[model samples]
Target: MKESVSYAPSRADFTGSPAVAASSASDGPSVKSLVAVTLGNGLEIYDFAVYSFFSVIIGHLFFPASNDYVSLLLAVATFGVGFIMRPLGSMVLGNYADRHGRKAAMTLIMGLMSLGVLMVAFAPTYKDVGIFAPIVLIAGRLLQGFSAGGEVGAATTWLMEAGGHSRRGVRVSWQMTSQGGAALLGAAMGAGLSHLLSDQQLYDWGWRVPFIFGLLIMPVGLYIRRQLPETHSTTAASTVANPALTLWREHRRALVLGILLVMKGTTTFYIIVYYMPAYMVNTLHMPASISYWISLTAALLTLLIPFWGGRLADRLPKRKPILIGCAIVSFLLIWPIFATILYGVPLGYTIALIAVDQILANISAVAMFLLVLETFPKAVRACGMAMVYAVGVSLFGGFAQFNVTWLLKVTNAPMAPAWYLMFCSVVSLAALVAWRERHHDE
Candidate 1:
């Protein structure tokens, strides 16, 4: 929807992409500083991703529609509530990061996310409170969403701002390690616990335990984030400048391109991390255990892509890895990962395909945090990142499950949703390819 960027591309700024050097107060980002910041950013992701894995359980507890499908929709919509509020959180939090300090923003966002998790863990279910059950869930997700929105931008930018030269790709790779690890850990608990619980017990109180445990991780994430260095200075001059306005004026083209690029990441994550779990269990009749286990393994394995992608970002034109990875995803997008699972593929095949799919997504995904951070100047960077990211996630990623579920219901065909995901993939890739950004660093 936004215009593509138009500018002369920058040259590759690093060699061999070893660990990058940080910006000296006199210089720019150094490699060690980027690595440290990324490590903290990774923990922030882990704190939030813990929610997505519990979608089905939450649906059963909070939103109890008579029909199972409707319940799923409601639960996801509740989840999307968090996704929807993220932009507002990002706008304010991003401003705070740009004005106050990245370290403060990281700590604040992570702390808020932890509070949201704790609330959800303690919330009474529909069985206990009638309509208030879902209301509470919605409120909790919004809080989580707000915090998560800011955390990604601030923490990720912290890493990019610090990684002055080499290994930017490698450092950025840590950003997603949290994503995979969170999914991996949450899935293990959800699937394992579900297997142990009586259906009644699970539907009743079993679900809250995981969320309660998620709260415990907050202090840890906060502790790590607190230890990371503040990557940028929010001087009065930069603070007074309206970054959103500045981005619109000077970096308009890059702003549009960045938003479109983010759409892909948003789409891919929902489809894999959020939507696939239900699809695998409901449509393919794959054991839910298999779905969760595969996700766990995939997330753990791909944790290194940000680091590797950062290398690519520094070594090649950022555009090369960005476009190439997105292009591959375009081809792979047309087929649903679970389409073959319906054919009764072996569990091993199912797991292998999921792993490979996640890997492609990882490679495609890792270049983004740095790409967006670099797209804008430091002054308006957070605003530019937050605005674009908020819109993409709200429209494309947040409503993902509902969209796919509706697609399946309308077509009355099993293969319809797979094609739908493919359509989204094509659309996403098209935006990337058609982008007008003149940065030849690709």
Candidate 2:
């Protein structure tokens, strides 16, 4: 029942020895530094999520196929394609972060993310460039995917390393909080665009506005990231020719279990936060604006919930209790939530139900993230987190929308997403139960 792999930290495992005393003396990173790191992450997520928010128009624009269904499938597939490069990005950038420094890796990814957004923001239409239109769009996604692959790992590792041990849970929890903020900002933009713009106007240019906004703020992120203190020391282990090999050889169980542990969160997030807008518009015939507003509301609630969860993580003796509780509750409630939404419940009630689910999912997700962060020793922390996060997201989260779209077309089952989430929940629960806990703090 017990796993052989262990991650007991040594003195070198401290992210940076100099910062430990300073961090422990206070709560965590200075507000300015914390804002810089989390803000960059939020912008990256906004750029990524904006694509899904406007997938319908994006489909009609760049992917222009014979039918609407095929066009949308192609559009979402392009979205998923970006994820295909995540693992590679994680390996390259994650390794770079480990070898160079967290500050260096964070600064580098900002430029790459900006470049990818530029391509999508200004790409020519299918009508203007024919095949080259989609080509440019996909190329942009690939670049974004690559940049993002290493982004989360480096950012989370930095927070963990820079913050005090007692506050690590709340510190790492900001990763999820930033994502919620991204979704919140993205949804507000979507809802506003949908409300203010006509169909012709929205399809013509409204979709590009968010990406352009992301580009405008990216320089600020890059500048701020450069000013942050380095969290990773360039030790001899970091200079290893092949950190990934060492990760696999020494931490195989953690990698495997971590991937499985991440599956439910990624799948649920992409489906609920990204795919639901399309599902409501396409399947239920709801107005796009209504879906956007609903998503906006959920994103707002989710944004505030993670801090509480983070606090809970800090208060608990072990993270497993909250993780298991949330998983089991989510598994039981998912089908009913979807059923209620489909059964013509009041729109207000529907929003409440979605908010409830998001709250539960987010709490568990925060706990899971903290657990994974502690599972790897500092030497390979960035690489390990990047690999686990990127692989799980690329394989499941990246394609969740596309898969559900295909399922609806084939099975015509409105509950398709619920079923998919259920299966993922079972897998996550199994992994959680099997996981051997090591409370590094304790």
Candidate 3:
């Protein structure tokens, strides 16, 4: 394993001359640049997770339905609305990144994302603004959806391109790592605030605090991104005319498989990580603070597992790890784990079950991301990735929470989430098999 690990060659190693190497070393991607490229993704996911975490309170303020369940459903539905705009954002901004540059598209995306955060953070409540309150919230989510549509493709492609082929898995894993970090941070904030504030206080104004914090850091993300060196060169971009059309005509099979691949990861992610807090509080009748802390712990584990998985990918056949991981999740983990949680176990037991599930799920997730990155050509990589990601996440991920909630309600079954996870795992595994054969032929 140690022998297989590849490091990026330094300027000194490449140049042979000491003085030239010293001067050129500063030109490569610095630690600051890597952080800058990933910062927007981290912050974008933080905003989205925070909204989900506080959905119960947000429903009261924005939707205000007579029945609490209806209000909560409406809030989650609005959250899904943001995903609907992601495909459009992918087409518009993803094409711009492919044709113009990743840096330019990223900058514009952050600006639009910040505007959406501001609207959500300070929008008038339903009581104060009547029907317009929900309208404003929807507009904000649409803007965010648009921004997020392009974020994954641009950021991941830039990281892979900048790191070169040797450590592509390590580089691409950082995108998901950043998202895990955001989930951790959001969970921590919710935990801390829930401890400090009363239910009335949390519902009234505490829910807005996380969004406000996100808004404050928006400028810093923008400044950092501005300093990033362009990974795709001008000459290469000029050679590709109509990259989107080319992707559609030439890479249609890759696109379909990409969507299926993304479905398992995104659905599992939303249910285990994003929806855990709600599941604990609403279903298990756990305290809000305790639920947040459990989620926070699982999130911390999620952040660490991907890097380990990426290292394994660099050392082994990527497809094998993905298949093994998916098998564990679908066959071994899902039903028994959810049953353990539903049977009213100790808090420690519940946390352990969740942590194990997340670790297995993330291992496959990092491998899938690296596979997608390798599947597309560099010229249209960003657009192709964005389109597939946006479409898959919109269709499955956007409705993940809503579907779970609805299923639980209709069936009155604690194991409903497990069934959903099982179905996604099967679909994704089939997609992985298809991609492996197709890639072999190519």
Candidate 4:
């Protein structure tokens, strides 16, 4: 099973790499350089998500509200603030990458996030600092948001920019795996932290541990990133490719289309990944440890998401499988997904159910970027991608939990998320129909 899951696709196997002119002497990344980019991606996602797993605890400490839902709502809203900042950073960083170089932007974004996490780790709460407590937390999250908005856009730009034409699919596929792994790590750390502390202690200061830990990881990632040479050569020849000025002129439509597709993904992602664990705790009476354990086990079991869909794209017609995967997630997941939630499920059943949902979503997730790589032409791809993807995530993905909670409260449905996902599926289907295949290589 592990062999099948971790099957490393060779360069000879991937014929989907983007075009470089015959006379152009473009230098693609070495295998080692690709690994660094992908690892950096994984670390960034882990650092970003660490805040969410500790949401309840952090909310209590920083926001200090009496109501459970209110505190959580505040923390989640604060998380949303990061999302709001993302698109702006995309404009700034995407342009910066386009103008300066992907490497410089990547380095700068990492440094910003490292400082943000460091601040959060040692931050004083409402009890200690009054209004300023939450203020600083928000500021740190905003910095994280800015970095995140730029980091992936920059890293992805580097990865896609640096790959060989024959194997862009497979090479970029390896680049995608880090996100799932990082998410799994964040869940594991949250669970481990839960185990380490008494409930009172967790409420007191234990929640801050994950923030500190995430800050510490930045240096390790920085060290790994140091090995890879700059993906974009910082030369005078590409001076016309400044991202801020050019993204609008060169990549506008690609950016717009990207938003629609990514919006579908962001909506579904919050349903299955972000909010599901909290739902388990609230509706099913699962302990924090159990929720963490189940989610982690599920993440571990289906960890090869990038490769699974990526290999299919490498060999088969990329469009059908990609579209089908989206349709399946949009359509098949809602009923059973929420049905299991409503049922008074035991631990075993809950774990199985969550694992299945992860599998369904994972099946189509990497196609999100695969499609992006294909749609946008090379020079402006980074800015185009960042703009559309970030906005889609912000408007649709960022507001997911708050929206559903409000809907559930208003409509009184245990399966409100199912309805929401169904709607997103409808949107994804529309996107699939509208999206043309960009198999210029074919």
Winning model by lDDT: 2
What is candidate 1's local distance difference test score? 0.64
The ten-residue window of minimal lDDT in model 2 covers: 1-10
The C-alpha lDDT values of all candidates are 0.64, 0.80, 0.76, 0.67
- Which of the two candidates, 1 or 3, achieves a greater TM-score against the reference? 3
Residue 271, model 4: lDDT of 60
lDDT of 4 by residue, 142-237 (tens): 987877777667777676656554344445555556666777888778778888889998877788777777677678667666666665655666
The CA-based lDDT of model 4 is what? 0.67
* Model 3: worst 10 consecutive residues (lDDT sum): 16-25
Clashes of each: 29, 0, 0, 3
Estimate, for each residue in 95-193, the C-alpha lDDT of model 1 and write its tens digit.
Answer: 788778888887888778777877778888888898988877777778888876776778766655653334445555666765666666666776677
Among these predictions, the greatest TM-score belongs to 2
Q: Rank the candidates by lDDT, best first.
A: 2, 3, 4, 1
User: Candidate 2 on 201-283: residue-level lDDT in tens?
Assistant: 99888899999998998888889889998877787844555667778998889888999999898888878777787788889
Estimated TM-score for each candidate: 0.80, 0.88, 0.86, 0.84
lDDT of 3: 0.76
What is the TM-score of candidate 3? 0.86
Off by over 4 Å in 2: 1-27, 198-204, 237-239, 284-294, 347-349, 439-442
Instruction: Tell me the TM-score of model 4.
Output: 0.84
